[model samples]
Target: MSKPKSIQVFEYSTLICGQEYNGHHFKKAHFNALVKLNEIHKGNYFTIGVNKITFKNYVGVLQVDGLVIEILPKIDQYESDSESSKIKWQAALIEMLRVTKRLKIKEKDEASVATQSKHLLDIYFEWFLAEVQKLIHQGLIKQYYKETSQVKALKGKLEFAGHIAKNVVHKERFYATHQVYDKDHLLHQVLFCALEIIASLTKGSYLYSTCKKVQLDFPEVKTIKVSAKTFEQIPHDRKTAPYETALAIARIIILNFAPNVKTGSENMLALLFDMNVLWEQYILVRLQRAQEKKGFTIIGQNSKPFWQNIAIRPDIVLSKGENENYIIDTKWKNIDQSKPSTQDLRQMYVYNEYWNSKKAMLLYPTNAISSEINEKDFVAFQETPNVKDHHQCSLGKISIFKEGRLDEEIGNTILKWFETSKNE
Candidate 1:
């Protein structure tokens, strides 16, 4: 089997006609698949132009037909299409996901993912395979499920209507509804379908053989068509709790899969995520981990009612010693410290006011080309003529990568900034 062609492009970058990027040709078929995908997704992922397709803030892998497009996050310093930069940013994105708990990588597989030169899709496929293998080793759970069928002998309760309708002439057959305890339930059904998809998509890749082996180990399950709602209808209990991670990954694979009935080769699978949400969660998780040791309490998406049936929430709120509260709003974009957006400033101001925080800071990720400004304070606004209370806001920069790796001490840095400002 021939390997599917792959292309690596940065988020918000454009792919034009006649462009061969990273040794992969941006062919017309690939473009057509993309257009069809955009139409299916209502143009949320990227915008299609006459001869070019420009990506949006989403960063992940999208495979259409025989082509795979891996979208890496764009850091200002690594704006160019350099192989080293691609590897760095790709690792950074995966690390962020792992930290945020979006991708669950076991400690044993961490080294494997780090050492291998797999694309994002392959990494995801391997993760799914690992989870399935673990479940198979530990044993897939069995549950009592209702099954209605025609049996030779009497079983559970008999459905008189079904019995009469189907077995009028055939008196030997009895139609009944029975409760059977088995591993062939909805959860395994979903996982089985996802494994089939992985088997098809990972062909000619390093994970193809392992995926096939895992599929062979999985129990035979009834093949049923599932939609997004089908996953939502799944019930969670002690028995189903262990399958959470596997089910989550399965949901991503099964839901995003779109098969082209006409040609069968233009099948599409997109696993894209909004970089903004990921950044916010990444920052929140890091801050909570770092501040837990201290006496500070960190809350994410802390919301309060602003109006009738409306609320205002900040990305993060840090409270220490009960009297001091600090607001942090994370932005994924790079901006001049001196020229923060008016809308953002107003939003921060509102957060400070509603949350009763003295200091509200707009936190941004810093890169090589970003401004030197670390934490620049915005002028304080007086509450009223008779009141002595004042509200202050600042624009702060946090370095996302340290020595080409994710900076795990970012929360400590922010804590230091708050302490220093308090002393002054």
Candidate 2:
């Protein structure tokens, strides 16, 4: 698919424990619209991603440039043809931002636009999630749910009344009342599926400083903040690109936080281990084996705009070299943190089927915090009837050490995978 024709950002909104909050507060929603939107999306019931739960720092009125995920603004305004946000969360976000006037970029004072505000940064996330909720509500998503309310007498005696009297008495009867619970299960399913892709895309964090290398100019975007002090401290030179500060931070994160890479494939895991670069970096490392021609392009055609195929993008397309090419996607989420709801594992299989890959692997972070699983043993768990019930398996060993020593740690692990593969 080509890029979406129209997109704009709006003030970001958030939900925690079932209440909506605007860009300003954390405990609850200030705006009625956001509250209504939260209910509509059932945000309380649906989680954002495993990483959202896994990675945490302090959050206040804003998402700091180096700390939280920065939502990118859309290029243009989109029309709201439907009252149903379920049909279009992006449009709703664009519309929502339009109401706030945060989406507007000043040609006159571009530098301030980049550094001064966090509204669109907020809107981008809200809009994206809203769009998802709308899609699930459209009825394309199907999941198993059964809940029924039981009608019982106030006292011990069972009560039966004639149809006419029953209406007056407020009587209802059911032989069985299975509690279907809330309708948000399907929404969670959708969110997690989207979450895996997005989380994997960015590795587990959404910090802009980690989005790209420092010094790389982000066109169309003015700035995204992860922290207040960082934002305030960045020099505001109009001639310099807005992301310059983010880029510089990204560099610090790279040199300090990420693993060391010696440029190409042999040492690319160093880049992949860097928490900032890991998301897209891991995907890139896997693609090194692909020939430009005669192979499936995991990211789609080179020209395909980045966000167009965000949801269903295949992880990898094995091409010419192998007899059987399989697509592989890595996820940083732990099923323990964000358990793999049926929808999650299903989407992984779906992508594999969509690309007609002979086999596929949904590579998880496999942290020791997760469990002590050896690689082969973990694969065997997949073959088990009820895999979720059993958490002890050896697929591969994964453990997390201090951030400073991460380079040495990750490098050793990658070396192990390479060695193990060679022996096999």
Q: Which digits, one per residue and each the tens of the lDDT, describe model 1 over residues 208-315?
A: 899989988989999989899889889999988989989999998988887752124556788898999999999999889889776679999878988999988999
Q: Please list the C-alpha lDDT of all candidates, in the order they appear.
A: 0.82, 0.32
Candidate 1 local lDDT, residue 375: 38
**What's the TM-score of every candidate structure?**
0.92, 0.29
TM-score of 1: 0.92
Model 1, runs deviating above 4 Å: 1-4, 106-115, 260-264, 369-378, 382-384
Worst 10 residues of 1 by lDDT: 369-378
lDDT of model 2, residue 9: 20
Error of 2 at 421 (Å): 4.0
Q: Evaluated with TM-score, which candidate comes out highest? A: 1
lDDT of 2 by residue, 389-414 (tens): 32211222233333311222332343
Q: Tell me the lDDT of model 2 at 185.
A: 42
